[model samples]
Target: MISKDKPAALILIDIQKGFDNIEYWGGERNNPNAEENASAILKLWRENEFPIFHIQHCSSNPNSLLNENNEGNEFKEEVKPLAGEIVIKKNVNSAFIGTDLKQQLDAAKIETLVILGLTTDHCVSTTTRMAGNYGYETFLVSDATATFNKKGVDGQDFSAQLIHETALASLNGEFATVITTDFLKQNLL
Candidate 1:
């Protein structure tokens, strides 16, 4: 368990409608209740008056489901940012790159981060790695993030669960302390 004494910020990354397009995203995904889990964490953060940051991914590729002009680019209803909450928009995977997310967190004197969102192997993983490298005590909510199937370099297919677990395994201990939303609620809430 992490120390609860330090100030913590909730970082929500790319929880958008684009992820709903399973076909566009390549195949079936893991964690059907990911949005609900994320919403639960968001509500806890809001209720406790913790700092919150919403990261929106605006893909540069026109064919991408996350393209700015596409309806799928819109944020999911569960994790939508309200007034006074910071929303960081980026075209890349890492939220820290090409964005003021680090500066904002630094300015707020955040010592820890509670992160969750769509595509666990992408934006969430990147941001968690960067956050760890930047010296923040980061906690990744495992069940709150989901990812779809993918093809490996050798044309081997990977299941969504495999990718998700692999990503979390890579991040655990090295990038962030991986925990479930239920654990967070039990301990922090």
Candidate 2:
């Protein structure tokens, strides 16, 4: 439902090296190509001169994988932004919680956001829900997002991939619309 009449922004979040580990997903999500997928979306946004925002997570503990000093905290090379792109750092799951994301969006007159990034069920989901609550039309690039597997509350081996799919399904036509890279590439003006 995103059209050229409504200004759209691309939000890329936390496609970091920490997501590349096998243990994070109980070995079920070994080869996630989120970076490549995100990169293609980024290219389209850049070519069209649409607003693009990059988000990075900062962990509170020095020992954490997303610690500011860790190379894993940096965005993967494939989706890394070019010079002059807006980059926002956050300490929570929602990028706008303590960041200037909302103000930036307002300044740019962006009413819609096309989101793609790492950990689909975490930061991506959090931001999508928040954006919806804040009245922004949001779309999630399903295949361009991923997540790591951790223990569920029931203590079972949760599948990160499955959880990601569930999150995508849950958001469709509610919090956000879930679309594919091909759909975006074809529909972007």
Candidate 3:
């Protein structure tokens, strides 16, 4: 549950259409309901008038699907930002790096961050680490974030489910509280 004493922000990181290109990211993606679950959370944040931020990745790699010029860089329909909501553009994995995310959060006096978006092991994980290090109470929604299968260092193929779980396991204690969408629905409502 979120603390009522401090202001919290819901950050949607790279929920861009580009991520739908499963094979490009790795292979099969886990958590097919990620976008739907994230959309539900976003609706809650909006109805309550809580602070919200949308992070967009303008990949530095021109060939990348998320490149600025690519339509794939556009936010997905389900959780697309409404007019006047804050949208931060980033060229890297971490939303806090080379962006005014920290500054915006600081300005808004935000103390807690609820992050859910894109591949759990990449951008989501990186931003969660920074959020925790920067002293923000961060919560990462397990079912609202997902990843694709990845090639192991030893040349083995890893399942998307395995990669997703491992990423959450690694970040659970040190970076953020790994939770499910059900947790939010039960407490926030």
Residue-pair clashes per candidate: 0, 1, 0
lDDT of 3 at 87: 98
Candidate 1 least-lDDT 10 residues: 1-10
Candidate 2: the clashing residue pairs are 120-146
CA lDDT of each candidate? Answer: 0.91, 0.83, 0.92
**lDDT value for model 2:** 0.83
lDDT of 3 at 31: 98
TM-score per prediction, in order, is 0.96, 0.92, 0.96
Cα lDDT of model 2 by residue, 6-25, tens digit: 65899999887776666643
Cα lDDT of model 3 by residue, 1-189, tens digit: 464556479999999999999988886999999999999999988887889999999998989899999999999999999999999999989999999999999998898899999979999999999999999989999999999998988999999999999999999989899888999878744
Error of 1 at 54 (Å): 0.4
Model 1 quality (TM-score):
0.96
Provide C-alpha RMSD values for all models, in order.
Answer: 1.5, 1.8, 1.2
On lDDT, the candidate that comes out on top is: 3
- Count of backbone collisions within predicted model 2: 1
Count residue pairs with overlapping backbones in model 1: 0
lDDT of 1: 0.91
Once model 3 is optimally superposed onto the true structure by TM-score, how far is the C-alpha of residue 182 displaced, in angstroms?
1.1
